[model samples]
Target chain A: MSISARNVFKGKVTELKEGPINAEVEITTSGGDKIVAMLTEGSVKSLGLGMGADAIAVVKTPWVTLLAGTPQYRFSARNMLHGTVSSFVKGAVNCQVNIMLPGGSPISAMVTNAAVADMNLTEGTPVVALFKASHVLVGVPV
Target chain B: MSISARNVFKGKVTELKEGPINAEVEITTSGGDKIVAMLTEGSVKSLGLGMGADAIAVVKTPWVTLLAGTPQYRFSARNMLHGTVSSFVKGAVNCQVNIMLPGGSPISAMVTNAAVADMNLTEGTPVVALFKASHVLVGVPV
Candidate 1:
C-alpha cells in the first residue's frame, strides 16, 4: 500500500506525561532530535508504550508552517526546529522550502509563493519550522 | 504568526494542468517525491506560478490514514507510501503510526486505537499510508 505523508522520524519513546484528556510522549531520534506528540489516555495504554520503547514520530508536510528569519515572539508550538534554507520550489499557489538542520535532518515547509517573495527566502536563509504538539502522532509497531 | 500543521514538503512545480475551475499542480520535492495538489485557478494566478516554479506541499496529520498489511482492493487515494512501523503512540481515541518509506522518509498515519488493534500493527509491520489529493492544501510563504 502507498501513503502520502512525507515527514517521518524514527526514534525511541523517551518520556510519557499523562493528563486527563491528553498524554505527552516524546520520541528522540538517533540524531538526538526530539519529537513530542499528544495522545489520549486510552491510546497510551493500547500502544503499551514506555520509556526506551522503540517508536516513531509522524508528521505531515502541510501541517508544517515555516517562518523565515528569527522569531520575534514566542510560539505555542512545542517543536521549533531551526535550520538553513537548503533549497526551495514554487508551485501554482505554494512554495516548498527545504531547511537543513544542524543535525543534518532536512525539514520541509510549504508556504505561499507570495510568502517566499515577501520573506525573501533564498539559499542559506535561516528559518524555523514550527508545529504544535497536538498535531503530532505517535505510533508503535505491531 | 504560528499556524498549526505537521507535514511540509519542498518541491518544484513540474506540471500544471488547468481546469475550468480548479487547476492541478505537481511539485517534485528535492527527494524526488512528487506531490500533487489541486487549487483554484484564482489561486494559481494569484501565486503567479508557472513552469519550473518552486512550491511546498502541506498535509495535516489527522488527514492521513494508515493501512496495515497488503491491500486487497485498490484505493482512490492518489498518494500511498509504504514503510515499516517505526513506532507509535496511542491516544484515547486514536493511534499514531509511523511508516518509514524506502526513500528513508517517514510518513505518519492517525488511526483509531480500535483500528490498530484490529490490524495488529507492530514494530517492523509493513503498512501503507494514504491520503487524497484534494485533502492537500497548497501554500506559499507570506
Candidate 2:
C-alpha cells in the first residue's frame, strides 16, 4: 500500500533515554500497531514535545527520490540526511565535503570539483543532504 | 571526545512525518553526524517531543556489537528492519533466518537458524531487533 494510507498513530513521550540525547515516543495505531518514534532530543524540544504530551505519527510506504547522475535508490523523506559543511579535504580531482549535523557528528560526502566550485561551499555553510531511507540498512544481533 | 561531552542542540519539529509501522528516527547530531535511532512512534510521544518542541541531540561514536560465527561488524541502532520469515537460504546450517531489511542493503552479519530457534522465533512472531550505533559507516556520495 502507499505510505500515505497507512494508519497514523498518536502517542505520548515516555522517556528520554540515554545515548546522547534521544527521545522515545509511544504510538498506538488503529490496527493496534504499538510503535515508538526515536527522535533527537533537540527535535523533541523544538516541537515542544515533552513527557506526557501527544504526538502524531504515521506509517507509510518508504519514500524515494531519484537523482539524475547515478542510479542510487532513495527511500522516504523521513530518512533524508541533512547537515552543514564542517570541513573539506582537498583532493586531486574531487573534494570531500564534510557535513556536520546539530548532533555534533560529521558525515563526508564527495563532490566533484566542478560541483564544489559551483556551490561555493565552505566551512560553516548550511547544506541539505538527502538520501533514501532504504539506503539505510537495518540489522539486529543474531 | 566522548559523545556525552558534546554540546546538544535543540530544534523545533515543524511537521509530523510518517513511515512504516516500525519507524526509525533520522537525526543529524550537532557535530554533523547523521545517525538513525530505531524506535516506534509510541516511544516518541512518551518522551514529550512534538512539532516545534525543542530536541536535544548529540554526536556519538557508533555502537558496535559482535555476533558469533559471523564477521564482526558494526550495526546502527537507529536503523531497524522488519520482515517475515522468508526462508533458509545459505551460509551456516541449523539456522533459518530471513533477510528482514530491504533487499540490496548492506549487512554486517547474517542471522542463523540456531539463533532463531534459541530465540523461539516463529513465522509471524514480532521480534524486537537490536543493533549498535557504531556499525553505521558514513561516507560521502561518490
DockQ of each: 0.06, 0.06
Question: Cα RMSD to native, each candidate?
Answer: 16.7, 20.5
**In candidate 2, which residue ranges exceed 4 Å CA deviation?**
A1-77, B1-142
Best by lDDT: 1
lDDT of 1: 0.72
Q: Lowest-scoring 10 consecutive residues by lDDT in candidate 2 chain B? A: B59-68
B68-102: candidate 1 lDDT, tens digit per residue: 66454343345666668888876554566777777
Model 1: CA > 4 A from native: B1-62, B65-142
lDDT of each: 0.72, 0.39
Cα lDDT tens digits, model 2, B1-142, are 2334222323333333434433344444333333344445565656644544444433221121112223222222343333334344433322323433233221222332334455455544433233433233222111
